[model samples]
Target: MDGRPMTFAKMLEETYTDGIAVLHRGKLIYERYFGALKPHKPHIGMSVTKSFTGVLAGILVTEGKIDPQAPVTDYVPELKASAFGDARVHEVMDMTTGLEYTEVYTDRNSHVWGLRRANGMAPIPPNYDGPTTIFDFLVAQKKQGEHGKAFAYKTVNTDVLAWICRRASGLTLSDLLSERIWTQIGAEEDAHYHVDRIGTESGGGGLSTTLRDLARFGETMRNHGRFNGRQIVPSSVVEDISRGGDPEKFKPAGYTTLPGASYRNQWWVTHNPHGAYMARGVHGQGIYVDPKAEMVIARYASHPVAGNAANDPVTLPAYMALAKALIAGG
Candidate 1:
């Protein structure tokens, strides 16, 4: 140890992490809970939900129910007038839709607020009435630029993919997830999502799951889709995400903390030596997978800041350091 006071403990304090579970070589090496969170309760997964959406998309694709190159209108005709109408399914999965939507959370009138209002996360004003359902808000989106030319971080892309998943599978995102992954993963508790007025799951950012279950998913991903003596997620899907998406496309997004990383199927691919990647949510939720070190970290936090920009510096370094320690000391 480099005289750096046990890094992970420091990170827990600095990031206001609610719970953390670390798995090394398929074993629980470290586990703890803080604040109001417990082992049994499901904490909000935030944008981590997008990663879940991505996994479901992979399942649908493997089942031959989804066509990545197909236009969004192939499934959701309501989006035919929206920007996504011209976009491919994979484009939405990769967030290259080129929509005019803004995700600036601090702004009162940002598109994110409108999304929150539709999904039951924000308070609806008595006198205001716009799109109250997720479907309505999505169809209202229009094009801003050329699709497939540049990567943009937009939550609505995941929502569109969720709708497409429903159309392709004839199953709601919740039910499809329950059938395809959750039950097979040996999750300790049932997970859920926040829904809209029409009971549509907010696939963009509304999942909730226990820290242990999150770790189970992470470990499954680390093992390339195998868990609990079965193939929970397809190995091909894991390989695609592990191989990563195009960095050239991801470069223009300019995430300061994620330099040289690509967004693929809603997962952030870190082109680091460890070949690390993460499913990240705003407010510090994550499933950091380091294939080289055979390690997976599942964390749920309520940091005062929403973006990982605040948490990544402290959390990422700590994770790498711990991975090194586990690998070398073993």
Candidate 2:
């Protein structure tokens, strides 16, 4: 893809894709599975869960339960002494909150592992006595720099936002998601989130859903939040996320593959000609929506690498190529 030719099959193989589905104008065009994955099985969504949390927050905002301009402490006074104490709700939603936590997946010692351990995603060491629950882990975070100044891809930000959502709506993350999105989309199967010690859902990276349901959600976004004869997500929330955040803030993040891209409400906005945006997860899971071409791609993968850098080189170009082809003929 970078000054070289690659086939679609080669891209899928190289990225270690497990399953993928493509929809155009709300109709399934292609579907396939590989490796140990089956059509009805639910694969872990990784960070894609953050997008769901973000959308849920947006819904609460529209309901007048959450004020984007309000300080994080207003909702969760428990975080008043943490890094999010001084952060605004919008900053957390956009991931612009400056926190000391780092997310270098290659580094086993990175703060992300601690988060995993706290959120029940990773096993805790016998001697390790860190926070065993998501709330404890979040309350211990320290501020790194000025909030709302630059973008940082830290998972804790989403967790904090999830706490805010819960405080405002008086509902757990799982129930809020089910009531607001899953059932509204007429999901083919039940979706779930892994929970921490105290039964709090890991809103950052703990969701699991089938590939077809993922495509349904993707198509819902492409159609301005309407799916299955109903408006699942408010159009205004979709519009705000699709509009994107300031690229200047996102520039410092240095995502080489996503030039001129911005993270808004946990979704990555490409700002390309197609006005494409995506909900991405570690290890190649993603829901790519290209509004211009009316195409939605839902993919679940188990790439050997944990970051999108390993898959974007091949996948991004391939997606654009398919969009171009569809625009030309289909």
Candidate 3:
């Protein structure tokens, strides 16, 4: 990536990339699958689902059914005693709720693990007694600090958004997606989210989709929510994400790999010269949209490392180099 051709095999090995698809000038330029991943198989999108949930919220926002400035409890009163009780809808969208939850993966006691259990992602023992639904897990969270004071990456915010979406629109996450985005965009396959005991879709990290489908969604976002001759997502929503949340709110998150980046509507705005932004998740899953170069790169990976820091150094440079090459060739 440093002024050299990237070694595809070497980078894939280093990052454990399962599937990748790249689009240039609004057309497919590259694609591949590896290591038990297939074109038809739907791999877990992880937190990439958050971006989808965020976009769906945008659809409701456009309909005048949901207001970003409204308090979450206005939609879901169940959160009245939790961290999200007094948080604004926009605060949840921006992940600044200041929840007491910790996401330490190695710590079995972390709130993330509890989230997994509640969202049907983890196995439950016979004697296990805890929150049995994503809603239950979310309502148990306690406030830790001042809301809207800082940006903290937490999965529960998306779950809360999903709940609000359901309450505001009277549609489940899966149903709303199919009715609004998936069907309109002409996705190749029917993607799904893992649901809890109560059949509540895990809006935070439960969606699974094929690599090509991921690219389609990324292209939809790149085109400002227009795809397949339809307005699948509102252009205003995409514009808001591209404009990004407050950099002052994002700086304290300590994402050294993402200097000058901001989180908005669950997308990461790089704020680089090319105006690149991305939908990122744990273990290297990402949908990078490079608007300046007119390119989109969708990837589904199973890297052994869960943190983006493990692969961002290699991936980000390669992505920019590809974007530059695509633009220069034209």
Candidate 4:
């Protein structure tokens, strides 16, 4: 050991994080829980759930169960009249759909809040009369720009893709994740998803899992979707995600915090030499995998800021620094 104390407990205490876990060479090197969080507790993953949805879609694609080139409406015909009618499945997976929904987390009236209401994450007014379900919200969305033209980080796109995954596989989001991933990855505990009154998993931002299980998932991806000597997800799926989407298209998204980042299959690609990529969520949930350094970091937090931009400056550099140190010691 370097004796520099990269323990998760220290990281959590110093950063004010809820939980932190680090895995190196498939072994737990550090782990910690703080502030109402425990090793066995299932902390909210926020949009980290989207990465699971994306991987499920990849499995469907690899199994020839879903066609990425096909119109999204092909699988969910109910959306034929909505903005997604003309969008391709890949567009949704890559978050390139130009939907009018705004993801401004700070705005109470933002489409993200509307999504929270529809998915039953937030309390709605008694007389509120908007789309009552996620599906309804999708069906009611209007076009903002042309699809496939640029990247727009919209949670609805993931929810739509999740619906497509469910329809194609005939499995709920939780079941698909459980069967295709959690169980196969040797997850330490069962994960749960927050659902609406009708019992629909909030595929966009509803999952909660132990910090160890979250690390297991990240390690699985780092190892090309294989864990416990089994192929949980097709290697190609991980390849596609790590390879990332078009950076040119991502530039217009204007993520000032991530100057050279690209969006791919709901994962954020840093495009650095270490090939570090991440599954990030609102309020600071993250699973970072650095292939070159053989490191994986899973974190769950409840920062007042919903945007990762506010947290990335400190967290991103720290992650890179730690990865480099791990590699140096090895």
Worst ten in a row by lDDT for model 1: 1-10
Better candidate by lDDT, 2 or 4:
2
Question: Scored by CA lDDT, what does every candidate get?
Answer: 0.92, 0.93, 0.91, 0.89
> What is the descending lDDT order?
2, 1, 3, 4
Arrange candidates by TM-score, descending. Answer: 2, 1, 3, 4
Q: Mark the regions of model 2 whose C-alpha exceeds 4 Å error after superposition.
A: none
Task: Give me the displacement of residue 180 in model 4, in angstroms.
Answer: 0.9
Q: Which ranges in model 3 have alpha carbons more than 4 Å from their true place? A: 1-6, 125-127
Clashes of each: 1, 0, 0, 0
Inter-residue clash pairs, candidate 2: none
Q: What does candidate 1 score on TM?
A: 0.98
State every prediction's TM-score relative to the real structure.
0.98, 0.98, 0.97, 0.96
Report the C-alpha lDDT of model 3 over 256-315, residue by residue, as the tens digit: 999999999888999999999999989999999999999999999988888898889889
**Number of residue pairs clashing in candidate 1, backbone atoms closer than 3 angstroms, sequence gap of 3 or more or interchain:** 1
lDDT of 4 by residue, 1-330 (tens): 223545534545545699888899998998877789999889999999999999999999999999999999889999988899899999999999988999998899899889999999888888999977888888999988899999999999999999999999999998898888887877778899999868889998999999999999999999998888888889999999999889999999898878788999999999998999999998789999999999999999988878887677678777888898999999
Best by lDDT: 2
- Which has the better TM-score: candidate 1, or candidate 3? 1
